[model samples]
Target: MRRGGAATRPSLARDTGLSKPTVGQALLDLEQDGLVRPAGRTSSGPGRTAVLYEADPAAGHVLGIDIGRGRLRLAVADLAGTVVAKVDEPNRCRSASALVRTVHDLATGVVAQAGMTLSDVVKTVVGSPGVPDRGGRMLHLAPNLPGWGRRGLLDELEAVLGPGLLVENDANLAAVGERDQGAARGVDVFVCVNVGTGIGMGIVVDGQLFRGAHGAAGEVGYLPYGWTDTDSEGWTPSTPGILEQAAAANSVVKLAKEHGVRNASSAREVFQLARQGDACARAVVEQEATKLAFLVASVSAVIDPELVLLVGGIGSNTDLLIDPLEKAVREISPLSPRIAPGELGEDAVLTGAIATALRAAQDIVFDRRGENLVTQRSGVNA
Candidate 1:
C-alpha cells in the first residue's frame, strides 16, 4: 500500500517476491475485509487490462496526541497514514484531571473534524515530556507540566482513551519523527537534542532508537556543568540538573537579565534583541551556543553519531546559533558531526506519535484477522 497509489496483483507479487497465487489470495482477503478496493484497470500493451487495487482510506484510523508544556496538539490519520485532521490549542490545564479532560476533548474535536468517532480509532499514541516508570504508573523528570508526575497518571489516560493508548517521551518521538520524515531521514546515527523549557536528547543508533536500560538513555539534562554557585543560584548540586539549569529557556532569560537586558521577558524576545544588534543579547546567545556545543561534544564523544539535530523552541533557532555551534564543536571535539536545525519544528512529536499509532493499529488489525483465520481452520479440522 505504501509503494504507490494503486498497484496490480502482478506488480505486488513482483515487488514482494510472492507467488502470483499468494498475492491473489492476500488481495482477495484484504478486499473481503474492506481494507482494499478496486481502482479501475491499466493496460501496458496489447495484453488484457490488469485490475489495480488501492488501500481503502476508511478501513481504520489512528490518533496521535502531543502533550507539550504550553500546548496540546492532536492529529487523526487513516490506515494509509494520511493525516485527516489536526488541532492545536493552548495548554492551560495544570492539574492531572484537567490535562486528561483536555486531551479527551481535543482528541474528540480532531476526530470529529476527520468524520470519525472515538470508537473508530484503532489506537492512540501520546508524546509527553518525561520517562514513564516501570508499570507505567507515573512520569518522572518532567517539571514543565505541573501535576503530571502523579501516580496512576497512565491509568487515568487509559481510562479516557481506552486500553490501546501508548505513551512515549516527547523528545524521543521527535527524534523518531525527524528520522522517519524530517531532517534525520536516512541517517543511521544521530542525536536529537531538544532545548526548550528543559533539555533532553533522543539517540538513534544503527537505524534504531537506542533507549538504554530503564528508558533513561537520553536524559542529557543531568550532565554536570561544574558551574560555581555564584554563576546561577537557581541550580545547586541537589537541583534537577546542571546542564538544563544553564542552557534552558529560563536560564537564557536569567542570563539576559544579568547582562542588563531590561524588558526582555522571554527567550524569544532576547533572541529578537540579539538579532537587532543588542550587545548584551548577543553575548547571551553566544554563551547559549557554547553551552549547546559542549552538550553536543559530550554526545559525540560517547555515541559518535553522524549528525546532531537541534530541536524544540530555543534550539531550532538555527539562523543565529548553527554556525557558532558548529565552530564550537570543532574546537572542543575531534568528532565534528553535522549539526542542523530540525525541519518539522513543533510538529515533529505529533508526526512521530501518529506513525507509531498507525503501526500498532496495523498490527492489531492483521493479528485479529490472522486469529480469525486460524479459528476458522481449527473448526474445519474439528
Candidate 2:
C-alpha cells in the first residue's frame, strides 16, 4: 500500500500474495493503529467500487536539515513523503554551539510552519560535512566548520533536537539524494563528486553507499598529489590534504591569481569571467577542471562507476566545465565514466537527509518490526 500510494483490498492481497481474509485482517489492524486510512473508492472491475487505503500522512512527520559552511537548509515532510514546509537561511553562527542552536531554531520553526511541533516529528536527519561517528558522540573530518568535530558534539545536538535524530555525512547524503531523486536513479553503481567549500566523493556500489573500512571511503581530499616524484628536491607536507590543496574552492582562487586574473576574488567570479571570454580566467577554470578530471579518472580506474554526479558550486557550472573536463579525462585515461551535473543542485544533502529520515520514520510510524534497518544500513559504514 505504501509503495503503490494506494491499494484496494483485492489489490493488496494480489500484491502481497496473501489470502483475501489475511489481507482484510491486516488492513483492519493497520487502520486501527492509525497508520493506514481509506482514500476515495476506486472501481477496478465493472461490478462494484472498492476502497483504496494509503499510509496516513497525519501519523507522523520527518525533518531533514542540511548544515553547510555558509548556509543552513531545512525541510519538513509528512510520513507519505510530501514536503510541507522548508527553510533556507544563511549560517551566521561562528561557533559550533551557536550553529547547533541555529539548527534547533530552524527545525522547530519549519515544523511550526507545517502546523506541528517538535513532538509531531517522529524522525529527524541532519546532513553535516563529516563522517558520523557510530558511537553517536562526534563528527569526524569536518574541518571547515569550527568546533564541528569536537568530542560529544552529537550528544549536544541530540540534547537540543530530542531523540530520533540521525546525523549523516553531507556528501554521502547528496549521493543518496541523487540516487533516490536525481541523476543516479536506477543506477546500480555511481559516484558523487561534491565541489563546494571542500572536495569529497560519495561512492555508491551495487545501489548502496560504500563508506570503506573506516567510514572514510569517499574522503578523496586525502588522495595523493604529485607523489610520483619521489626524488623531488623540494617536497613539503601541508595542512591542506592533497586533493583539497589542488582542487578545492580556495585552490580555484589561488590558481586564478597565479595566472594573473588579478580581479578575481572567488571561484564563482572566475567561472563567470571564463564564461565572458576572459583568457586568464578561462585558463584558471580549465586548470581547475583538468585537476578535477584527474580525480574522476582516478576514481574510475578503481571503482569504475557507471556515472559520476558532480554537485555544489563548481559542479553547478556544468555548461562550462563538462566539455573541457571530458576532453581532459579522455586524454588522461582509457576509462570513460559518464559525468554529469547532479539534478538536486545545492539541496542534494537536504533532500538526501529527508529521504533517510523518511525511510527511518516509515519503519517506526507503522510498526516496530525487527531491528532499525535504516540505522543498521547507515551505521559504521554509512
TM values, all candidates: 0.89, 0.88
Give the per-residue lDDT digits (tens) of candidate 1, residues 302-337: 999999999988998898999889888889989898
In TM-score terms, which candidate is top? 1
What TM value does model 1 have?
Answer: 0.89
Instruction: Report how far off residue 106 is in candidate 2 (Å).
Output: 1.0
Counted clashes in each candidate structure: 0, 0
Which candidate ranks first by lDDT, i.e. highest? 1
Q: Model 1, residue 111: what's the lDDT?
A: 90
RMSD of 1: 3.3
Candidate 1, residue 374: how far the Cα is off, in Å? 9.9
Clashes of 2: 0
Tens digits of lDDT, candidate 2, 6-101: 889998778867677667766776776677799989987788899999878877889999999878999999876789999999998889999999
